[model samples]
Target chain A: MDIIVCVKQVPDTTDVKIDPKTGTLIREGVPSIVNPDDKHAIEEALRLKEKHGGKVTVLSMGPPQAGDALREASAMGADDMILLCDRAFAGADTWATSYTLGEAAKKIGYDLIICGREAIDGDTAQIGPQMAEHLELPQITYVRKVDVDNGKIICERALEDGYERVEANLPALLTVISDVNKPRYPSVRGIVEAYQEKEITTWTAADIQADEKCIGLDGSPTSVKKSFAPEPKGEGEILEGTTNEVCKQLVAKLMDKNVVR
Target chain B: MEFALNKEQEMIRKTAREFAENEIGPIAAEIDETTEFPKDTVKKLGELGFMGMTVPKEYGGAGMDDVSYAIAVEEISRVCASHGVTMSVNNSLVCWPLQKYGTEEQKQKYLIPLANGEKLGCFGLTEPNAGTDAGSQTTVARKEGDKYIINGSKVFITNASQSQTAIIFAMTDKSKGTRGISTFVVDTDTPGFSIGTIEQKMGIRGSVQAELVFENMEIPQENLLGKEGRGFGLAMATLDGGRIGIASQALGIAQAAYEESVKYAKEREQFGKPIAKFQAIQWFIADMATEIDAARLMVYKAAFDKWQGKPYTVSAAMAKFFASDIAMNATRNAIQIHGGYGYTKEYPVERFYRDAKITEIYEGTTEVQKMVIAGNLLK
Candidate 1:
């Protein structure tokens, strides 16, 4: 089995800042970390590799620096890593980003593909499904449980009310939530080995054979017209006096505003 | 002139960060609150090859570089300081000594099991009467024919109760003071060997700390580590590497605290605006970030030096001192930034604040680190 785990390098949201004038995210000096949910996805891939005995490759599309995420995957027991990085991939919305990643996955040719349910910064919940559409493959999103046997992928999707179980054929995409499995710490030795042995394979848009018109800001359809801080709501007026008086006043206020039927 | 981390180092940082965030972060408070050692998690770490970071692959270790070891320590410490110490003790205190000084038979017997995480190990150096004054240790070892009879007690030993093996320092020749001290690898199952009471600590409570008593504990001559009079030097060398782990641990704790504070500042509202919009809060965030970055650089430099097999004692001391102090300060600022909410245990920053103080005291005290640095400068 060949599994490809999609990862992203995002500014540690904890350190993210907003540009006051442009209302854009200020990324400078913020440390970049692998997306939290993606870690669960990688762990799932690793578990699959261990049980099924196959290669696990990690793929990421971002700036050149995103190679860090790939290398990280390698250290955490991924067999291989590829970074689909280029200036052309910058500022892409979820649709364009998913399309490019899907294309890269197609080029890699994997039996399974996995990704985080959503990136913390975007919170779009669109990338995995959109990638599945682009690749024309079945997708199981918000997957909390996954098991592979008899050439079939069985998963439980977390829904609002409860969960839905689905089984798919080979060559599928899974968007994992953080509750899937606990990711393992890199051993002292694994860290050293990763430090000494792993190299991230970097690919540009040309390398992935991506269409120029389908990437970056130019390829993205949605653009923010304006971004500003949320407006504050007014504080509630306190009703003072005896409990009965306060209750009466509150009722009268509600009646005056026609809040009570 | 390449200042950037190579692919492997980069991967180590990434993997550790991910693991810390996904596995260790959520449970840190619970474990700290319960004072329970994360045994299952530690076992998982061992299976992942974390137990013997610097030990050679031949010894069942991952045989990674010093940078990786430091990075792992930093990452684990970022989420849980107790786990970080467990890793450090295994890598720096237990495995490193065996690799450097143990004979082939001893290495096979001790290092392999320890590196494989099949067994837990600890170092017995600090005692009730001796800490910074390690040479003043009163544990005595008397040679009797083919065996040595050891009698003494070690206190405040991390991982002591749960550990299967311990490398203990005992004096063979009382007249020679430090030079008379020698190290011996002791199996916990040996007769007359018993673990004393577990210490109630202020922080890193998830790691077990206890007293080890060796009363007429007999061990074969083959258990000796290195030369007869090299225990002091061996202990010092082990601590040099250990300090790097401690520095990284401190860096992790501080980084986590700073990150939590930043997140809270941005989301928390006051006076019709996010608190982050206020200059006072922004300044606190800025200082925390700057300090954490500086501490990270210092720790990395020390780790890099250790990787290169250079003399990193002074650098390690400096890194440990600075990083631990920064951790304390960063957690303090994180609490202040959160205001009343920070005071409550409902938030993680309060736990971080409680956890950070111990970093300055253990591995080496701040005063001790300054002394080490100054002594190196003078030399």
Candidate 2:
């Protein structure tokens, strides 16, 4: 089995600050880290590779700096790291990103595909299902538990209150949640090997034979008109009077506002 | 001369910091209060290839450079000095010597398990009478046909009770003084070997320190490390590397203290303003930050020298003394900056203060470090 995991490098949101005057993110000095949920995806892929003997390959699409993210996944025991880096892939929305990744997946061939439920920066949660549709493979999103045997993948997709069990055939895709598994720290040897011994394969738009019309900003349809931090909520009013009296007053106010019958 | 860490070292620092903050930080206080050994976390560290960072991979170790090892020790110590010393003793004191001097058979038998973290090891050199004057060792080993009879007691031995293997020094020829000493690897389970008294300590309590007594302990001749009468040189050489680790540990302690002081000064209020608004507190923070950075550079220089196969005895000594001094001073100021809360266990500054003291005392004292540095200059 050969598993391909898609990862992204994003600004560490914890340290990111918004400019109060301009309403734009200050990203100059912010450190970049692999998307947190994608770490779970990499960890799950490695676990699957361990239980069933196979190779685990990690792939990403971004600038050259994203190679660091791929190197990190390699340190976590991924067999190979590939970065789809090209200026032509710039300004890709979820659709263009999915198309580019799906094209690469078609070239690499995979027994299974794994992706995070969503990237923290974008929070679109569309890439995995979109890629699945492009590749015409079955996909299970919000997967919390997975079992594989006899070319069939069984997964527990987390729901609002519970989880739903779903099974799919081979050549499937999974978008894992943070609860899927805890990621392991890279061993000292792993870090050394990742940097010294392994080479990250870089593919461009032409290498994956991506469609020129669907590979960059030209293919992306969504556009942001405005972005700003949400307004801070105001303090709530405290009800006055005795318990019964306050309750009656609350009910009357709620009724008057059509908040209650 | 590059000031920045390379990609590999940066990754090591990141991994260690994450591990320290997420896995060890929550339990640090609990372990200190209980004085119980942190066995589970130590085992986890072993799984991460931290127990023997510089040992070769073929020998079941991580095979990392000395700089990477230093960064790891610093990160771990930043959160818990007890774990820091545990890792330091295993890597610098035990596995290092075994890898450098042990014969293939010895490496096969002992080094493999110790390096792999399947077993733990401790160094046994400090004695009741021998502290800084390590040449005053009194333990005796007498040849008895195919075996040697050992008798003596060691004090302040780290990981004494829990260690599966011990690299001990004993007087094989009393007339030769320090030259008579020989190094031997002894299984802690030998018939006459026993843990005597566990010490109650003021700092790094989460790591055990105890007395070891060897009463008529018998061992085969094959356990000897290097050649007879060469133990003193081997021990001294080992301490040179060990000092680098201690220096990194001290740097970590000081860094933690400085960070705490900065955080506390900004939030603590007095006289209608945050204490950070005061010039006096600002000076302390500035001095701490400056010294901590200096100590880190010294440690890195020592580690880099060792990695490059350059002579590093003086550099290591200089780093150890300077870094440890900063650790002590920084932690003291950290407590002062926190006012009454710093002196109490409500904050970790008090714990850092206690842990900082041991860095100056262990491996070699500050005075001994200066002696090594000055002695080289005079010569």
Candidate 3:
């Protein structure tokens, strides 16, 4: 089983700064980290490899600096790392990113594909499903639990109130959530081996045979008009009385605003 | 002239810091209060390839450098000195000597497990009568055919109660003085081998310190570490590396104390504003930060010298004494900065103060370290 994991490097800080004029992230001076969910995805891939016996390869489509994220995945026991680094892949939105990653996946070949449910920096939650569509492979998104055996995969998809169990054949993609499993820290030996011994295979848009028109800024369809923190709403009224009375008051106030039917 | 850690070393440091903060930090105070060995975390450290960090890969170690090992010890000690010392004794005192001096069979039987963290190992050299004067150790091992009958006891042995294996130094030929000491690998489960009194400690209570009694304890002749009568040299060589670990431990303690003091100074208010606004508090923080940075560099340099295969005896001694002195001073100032709260158990500075004292005493006293450095200069 050759499992390929898609990862993204995002600014380490939670208070992400945006360029007011450009309507893009102000990334200078900020440290980068493998997106939290992407790390969980890598950990799951390694866990599956350990159980099913196969190579785990981590793939990312970002700048050359993204190689650091790939190396970190390798340190977490991934067998191979691939960084799709090219100036042609810059300014990519989720759509172009997925298209490029999907093309790289097709070139690498995989029995299983795993992606994070979402990157913290880009909370669109579209790349995994979009990539699945590009490859025409079945996908289980928001996956909290997984069981793979006999060339089949079973996953528990977390929903609003409960969960939905889905089964798929081999050669499937899964977008894992944090609840899937607690990730393991990279051991000291693993870190040394990753940097000293392992080679991170770099791929370009041309190398993956990606459509040039469908990559980078030219490829992205959606552009942010503006991004800013929303102002806090006015203070709320405190309802006092029994629980039922408070609930009635709340519903009456919500109805007055037509917030809910 | 480069002060930065390499990529590998940086990764190791990051991993150790994360592990120390998340896994060990929460339990440090609890374990210290209970005096219960952090068995689970120690096992986790083994899985993280920290137990035998500096040992070679073929022997089930992480095959890391001495600086990386020191960084790891520092991080662990920053959160919990007990765990730090446990890891230090294993890597520096036990695994190092075995890898350097043990025969193929010895490596196979003992080094592998100890390095892999499957079994714990302790070094036995200090006796009740011999502390700084290690040359006067009265424990004797009489050679009898294929076996040695060891009839003496070692006191203040770390990990003694829990260890499965020990590197025991006994006077095989007392008539020859310190040169008569021979090193042997003795199984703690051997007949007539027993753990004596477990000492109640002032600090690092999470780690056990006990007396090891050997009454006619039989050790296999093949278990001898290096040639006969060479134990003293081996022990000294081992301490040279061990001091690096102790220095790192002290550096970590100082770092913790300094950080705590800074935090308290900023949050604690005495006058119209935070205590940090005062010049007195500012000076303490300044002095602590300076000392900690210097001590860290000294510890790292000692570790680097050892890694470069340089003669590190005097350097290790220098690092040990300097870092430990800094640790004591830093913790003292940390308590002073925190005022009454720092003296209480609520703050970890008091614990740091207690733990720092041991670093100045164990491995070698500050006076002993000075003697080592001066002795070299004089010679």
Scored by DockQ, the top model is: 2
**For candidate 3, what is the TM-score?**
0.94
Q: What TM-scores do the predictions have?
A: 0.75, 0.96, 0.94
Deviation in angstroms for B89 in model 2?
0.4
Q: In model 2 chain A, where is the ten-residue run with the lowest total lDDT?
A: A223-232
DockQ of each: 0.44, 0.80, 0.77
* Predicted candidate 3 versus true structure: per-residue lDDT over A1-261, tens digit per residue: 899999988897575676766656688878788899998899999988888888998999877878888888988899889999999998988889899999999998999999999888778889999999989999999999999878899999999999999999989999999999888999878888898889989998889998999999899998877777555489978999999999999999999999988
RMSD of each: 6.0, 3.1, 3.5
lDDT of each residue in B255-357, candidate 3, tens digit only = 9998899888889877679999999999998999998888888999999999999989999999999999999999999999988899999999999999999
Q: Enumerate residue pairs that collide in model 2.
A: none
Better model by TM-score: candidate 2 vs candidate 3: 2
lDDT of 2 by residue, B59-152 (tens): 9898899999999999999999999999999999999999999999999999888888888899999999999999999999999998889999
Query: iRMS for all predictions?
Result: 3.2, 0.7, 0.7
Q: Write the per-residue lDDT of candidate 1 for residues B139-198, one digit (tens) a residue.
A: 999999988999999998999988999999999999999999999999999998999988
Better of 2 and 3 by DockQ: 2
Candidate 1 - chain A - TM: 0.84
Every candidate's TM-score, chain A alone: 0.84, 0.89, 0.85
The residue-level lDDT of candidate 3 at A108 comes to: 89
DockQ of 3: 0.77
Q: If the candidates were sorted by their lDDT against the true structure, best first, what order would they fall in?
A: 2, 3, 1
